[model samples]
Target: MKSSPLALGLLALGLLAPSVRAGLTAGMQEGKVELKSISQLAFGPEGVLFIADPKAAAILAVATGDTAPASGSATLRAEAINEKIAALVGTKSDDVIIEDLAVNPISRRAYLAVSRGRGPDAVPLLVRVDVQGQPELVALDRVRFARAELPDAPADVAPAAGRKGGSPRTESITDLAYADGRVLVAGLSNEEFSSTLRAIPFPFSRVERGTVVENYHGAHGRFETRAPVRTFVPYRIGGEQHLLAAYTCTPLVQFALSELKPGARITGKTIAEFGNRNRPLDIIVYQKDGRDYLLMANSSRGVIKVAAEQITPAAKSITAKVSDTDGLKFEKIDWAGVAQLDRLDARHALVVRTGAGRALNLETMALP
Candidate 1:
């Protein structure tokens, strides 16, 4: 194989380091991070960790400095993860709440967003799981980090429409993901169209208002705009980047990345209605036998494996009422009580699920 002239020029300009070339950390500053809360976590290039602080209406990008390429097999299993985290934090197992889990693609290490307590004063902490499945706190004492504050976060005092005593502000950021040098944030905003999806460029520039999004819910027999996306994953459809977002009452919608412009209102294509009265907790995209699939964890529904081949460019939208699951057929996996998940390797997934005695457990399972 021979290097092309463009490759040689790029090498000379040091553009091979995708992160540096894209200014992933160009404007970041080194300091201690004061996180008010940890609602979600995602990993970008060069071990940069994106933490969502919904309470603070901000997103922090921390350079985790865990970029050493993983060696050998990265399979992991840790039973009773809640107890382990409680023991590590000197709290009761029942008080430990794991909010989210993300695996560093480069290091293959798992990082968790945890709440040490279950009350309003609960302390937020980030924990790292070693190759041996041991939980360790990630110190925020002095690290390179950048913060992006949402300019139009909902009012913290406003009570949610249906949930009594629940503040809409707390749902300002429900999910976070890194894709193609941008951080995609899904949650509610103060704008008239509360439900929003934001795409923020890396290196922390001026945070802009999010793109308002709406979707037709087949199970509900109506369109909804105020409900935030519970979970979503970036996927390619017909060779173009798009987001596959799952919302409460289980509607799977698709939005093109190019259409998520600032302050724009867009209607997503509803491709599937998984069911009703269920919340999508997490989602991961993987490939098997040269075909892509979506592994989703739900609150009431068990894990499901959805074939990505059905999301073709000409796929019809599910607009009518649904009795059960409709559009883009799925196979329910035997996995039960799954709360959070991430891809650990090419052939395995790291999942946190309830085990005996309702205790949470972390384990890696083969991609079905």
Candidate 2:
């Protein structure tokens, strides 16, 4: 995600808010490869960390188990999990760009959000690729990923407009997640700030054709404009299923799964807010030592950590700003994607730094 000077100015103003206790500081260890551009990341079972390198046309994997290096040294090294994933779909890398990454907790399979072109002709798609098997890539549009049982649209919303590619059809999917045999996709628009969210109830490996579950416009609240929703993660709050969504143009938005159902009317009461003016590039939820944390990667702020408890709708803000005299502040890092992993007794994470060079640099941080 690229940040403009105007956006940075807004973030500086946001820092003026009341200060709170700064989160724990974690040791940072850089990765091996220089990632030109990364989309998203996820940590699989055991100690495997998966990174989506769209520009490189491959997925990078790192093992952060006992084999990791000692302290002060880079613990993660980028290895190509599989190359030419787009080729598997009979398309060349130039014709398709990988945009998002998701890992299924139950199936242990990784999914990629692929976009097909550079212009309006570009068709956005969701594909599931095997990380452990022969590494086959299958498009979700080919098969139903899940059962669709959404409410009927209001009579005011014309039927033709309610169909996909209607008045406000999404052109890109920025984030994806699979859980309980259902896939949640976050739609982003390059021409507009608002985005859409859809839930597909089927396995990625079997999706035959593209399906629409729900479309969220910005009419619900002040934070609900046509902002570019960059990431989405499924989080369990107080034992209830909810969705944590972040945008690059606005603050974060949270809502229950029930409220996100297709054709379901949602309002400010159904949404929770987080983050500041800084554009959030990616987000991940990790549990360490029985404690849960929300890790966010901001374009201007390297990585910000917040306790899960502070994510309530009542919280005044999402993160607390810290002072630095050595200029060792978050601005020094150009973060693209982030992931959290558990390696033995240590909690590890990998962050992809973009625009620095050709190879993807993975930074390992020790979780407190």
Candidate 3:
């Protein structure tokens, strides 16, 4: 549960008039959108869907106009969602790849970034799940949309230096989120210090060079700059906005939102090392009993719950290496086989988890 942005707050309170909200797309064009690939998905005010296209090295903001307010208490459960999506698209469950899931806060409907096939030619599809747990394709054939291209994205070719085998451009934009009117993108860049984070102001402006980030990876036992942030959530610490970012070979690093400037290099404060041989998949912030908490899903490590109250401005940074996980205590959750997760509402979470016969099921559960 990343902190809801101001736009969301206003929309929830019915303070953002339809005319004022339409201003968010004032400069945008309306037409068919051709996406090279869809890597990440996020939502902004007035039902604007932010789609990250790594292959094209661009971000497309589309006016989904799905602003129908939802009953916050409603829940959704679509079992074997992958198979269902495959059936809907005339494919097999194994061929349907669910790239990411995002819950449109206003609609309380789930949107999934899906790859219809598994090769380079795999078609990208944006599928929306209704409250009745049904899957439907979001029509992007003709829509009001705007695009922002990264000025310094990595080349769309080959294995990058010091890497085994994978397209550098594919990881050019690993994760992005809309917060405080800006879309924060994290991934590799073409610069010498490649791990970058860009805070591109919304409404489709020119994308500037992102702030290069480096952190002390305890598992690797040294400082690193190439490993991109796997997943992160926007949070507030000491009355200022910050990103609680997690990286591969897990390191929980903190970066002030204000410090992210064009062409600047910043060393994030490493607060915790969850361990090596693990990749953080997704993270969300939620509150229970009036205290905030962070729930993160991992590959090797099970879902872990961190008391957000522990993350303070005075918390010490883990500058030195340790044998395993260290700094900022966290408790493992009982959730199993969770591949992706997002907050469906304040009280429920939408998860794509493994079920019988290796099938992926989409279900909503009470926030743990």
Q: Which candidate is the best by TM-score?
A: 1
Error of 2 at 174 (Å): 1.3
* Model 3 alpha-carbon drift over 4 Å, by segment: 1-22, 154-171, 189-193, 206-225, 321-323
Put down candidate 1 lDDT per residue, 171-240, tens digits, no spaces.
Answer: 5577899887678888855444456777887767664433444433333447545556778899989999
The segments of candidate 2 whose C-alpha lies over 4 angstroms from its true place after superposition are 1-75, 79-170, 189-194, 204-226, 268-277, 312-346
Give all candidates' CA lDDT scores.
0.82, 0.45, 0.81
User: Is candidate 1 or 2 superior in TM-score?
Assistant: 1
After TM-score superposition, what is the CA distance of residue 86 in candidate 3 from its true location, in Å?
Answer: 0.5
lDDT tens per residue, model 3, 1-368? 12258877887788875534557877688899999888789888778899998888788999898988896488788888999999999998899999999998888889999988999898989999977788999999889998988765444454466576744333457788988777888876544445667788776655443344443333334644555677889999999999998876568888788887765666678888787777899999999889999999888777888999999999978867577877889998888888898998888888999998968899888888
In the order shown, what is each candidate's alpha-carbon RMSD? 4.6, 16.3, 5.5
List residue ranges in candidate 1 displaced over 4 A.
1-23, 154-170, 189-193, 206-225
lDDT (tens digit, per residue) of candidate 2 on 300-364: 55665556775554634323232321111112233343432212113655443432333222234
Better of 1 and 2 by lDDT: 1
Q: TM per model?
A: 0.87, 0.50, 0.86
TM-score of 2: 0.50
